[model samples]
Target: MEDRDWLILKTIYEEKNMSKAAQVLHVSQPALTYRLQQLETEFNTKIVHRSNKGVEFTGQGEYLAKYAVDMLNKLRMTKEIVESMENKVQGTLRLGVSRNFARYNLPPLLSNFLTKYPDIKFHLITGFSSEITDLVYKEEFHIGIIRGNNNWKEQKLLLAQEPVCIVSKSEIDSNSLPALPRIHYETEPSLQSVINNWWEENFTQPPFITMRVDRIDTCKEMVKNGLGYAIVPKACLTEDDILYQINLTTRDQKEILRDTWVIYRNSSLELTMIRAFIDFIKSIKQEGV
Candidate 1:
């Protein structure tokens, strides 16, 4: 099949619905259906089936979809290579970033980068650090920015190391932390584990959690309103917030730090765009942003 056919299969697999795939592919529903029928006929088997949820791919369809994804990635790489031969650093930079970073840090960083390399396009996906790391590992993204550590063998660079702290609306005794109202927010599992471990190390009793929120910003607002205290990375704090902040430390008296990392496969650096982008990020860190 042609590259267009591969793209159609890949889009169908990703969208999981004929109409949605049609919209993404910028084709009519009838045209997409005809294309799928043609693919099925060419393969001499049913490619997909309708389900209550949406379209479900058969085993053969799944295999073809995987192949289609590989083909698309290779095609993209080839194009990038050809373009780079002319000494141009321009291409789509697919990046997966943590939600917190996306909300707070990414805008300025992207603004500066895009200003410098106007030809470079960005496709950003934001989620939990764990989810972003998975996307990077799956080669779905050329780069990933995540909070916390990874056990993967891919190349990783430390972007920043900020302290985790006890934040509250009013001054609270660190010695009596377990007795006070605690505000917990759902975050990356690794971060939560670090906070839990720190708590377990210092206190015999569990925290008196007053509220549980889904977002870090919400947790910060709750603490700012005198609701409770939360243990979060320092990225949540700003100079404008007049909150009581107590930096955390381990039992051995080392600072409790939260790290943000830039991760990518070494092989991906072959693309001039990715290489330039990585260098740009490193330069920003060097300039102490």
Candidate 2:
């Protein structure tokens, strides 16, 4: 019912125990318990079920938790907006990025943003595109830059397009399909299925299978060592000397060209910081850099 009660509920959800939540909130245990009891009495239902180990949210608690999070986010955004009007842009910005972008794309963006706003702190979470998308929807991230897929929401920007490349060692002759290793990235099903379909259409038969890994860096490393031929984004390849590109003509070779996007929810755009960030991205493009 009150902000303090919601805060207590959030803390309990995080800490999972009354004593721990009280300690985290810098309040007496009895006071925290009383507040939670008051909330339960006001709602006429048990919000949380206490146990020896920790607390578990009841059905009512779960429903209220969602409302609490939405309320807290709105409150925080309101505070941030008011503060920004006073010429201060200082708050935490959570970002969700794929493992691919974390390596290839994040450095420059992070460097420039941090240099420009030294006071603003950042928390970067890296996972696959599917995981990042889920996080973005859950409000875990203010914005996410992810690889474009049909399943993603419509609100996204075409940031950059990097072609899919097949790389192998120079020593291997291209006259005949060598019995070399074949490396595949163990990414989300959407992209992985696309890769499989493209590989089948492009190659006469599957090449010798050596490894399947999650990260593009591993694929790149294996390719450099002549472990196998790998299909990956051109962005991952930094060295021009060790690896040789084996251009392929697949049915969806045109579609293999991956376009990166910046995605955010409609509600997130209402926040000044989020809007400024999107505007900054637009400004960067306008500068042609």
Candidate 3:
């Protein structure tokens, strides 16, 4: 099949919906269907089957899709290598970052880096730190900016650390936390583990959870309205937030912190854009951004 067919397979596999894939590829649904039919006829096989939700791939289709994704990755790598050979730091820098870092830290850092290297482009994917970790392992991106110290044996630089803290609308006795209403939210497992461990350290009883929310911001709002207290990262709070916070501490009297890391494989450094961005990040760290 041609490059476009490979892209079609990859996009269809990723999107899991024919219409969505068509929209993403900027092609009509009928056109996409026709192309798939052509591919099936050429290969003398049925690739995908219609399902209630979207579509499901046959085993042969799955193999072809996997090959397509690998091919696309190799193609991008080829482009990166070719661009590196030029005396310019220009190419799409594929990055996977945690949603928290993307929301709070990435914009200014991207701004400054782009100011210096105007030709460097970005293909960023942001999700939970856990998801980013899996993406990193899949080698879909050159770099991953993630929160928490995860199981990465490859090269990683500690970017920053934020204190883990408890927040409420008003000050309350530390000893009374177990009895007070607590707001719980869904977050990465690592952060949840840290909070759970800290809770176990200071309290003999379970938290009196008043409400469960889906996001950190929702928990923050619940705390702001005096509904309950929540354990969260200090980076989630702003100066304008009129909430009382107590930083969690370990038994050794050290503050509990959530660390952000810039993770990348050493082999990626062969690309000029990768090296340039790494250097830019090092400068940012040194200058205290």
lDDT scores in order: 0.90, 0.75, 0.90
lDDT of 2 by residue, 106-151 (tens): 8898788768777777789988788888888877678888874746
- What TM-score goes with each of the models? 0.94, 0.78, 0.94
lDDT of the structure predicted as candidate 3: 0.90
Candidate 3 lDDT over 1-289, as tens digits, reads: 9989999999999999999999999999999999999999999999999887998999999999999999987887787788799868898998999887887778988998999999988999999888887777777889999998698989899999999998999999878998999989988788999999998998889999989999888888888998989988888887778999899999998999999999998778889999999999899889988
lDDT of 3 at 212: 96
Please list the residue runs of candidate 3 whose C-alpha ends up more than 4 Å from where it truly belongs after superposition. 51-53
Clashing pairs in 3: none
Model 1 residue 127 distance off true place after TM-score fit, in angstroms:
1.0
- What lDDT does candidate 1 reach at residue 176? 94
Worst 10 residues of 1 by lDDT: 79-88
Q: Among these predicted structures, which one has the highest TM-score?
A: 1
lDDT per residue (tens digit) for residues 1-289 in model 1: 9999999999999999999999999999999999999999999999999887889999999999999999998887787778877778888899999988788788999999999999999999999988888888878788999998778687988899899999989999999998899988988898999999998999999999989999989999988899999998898687877889999998889999988999999878888888898899899889998
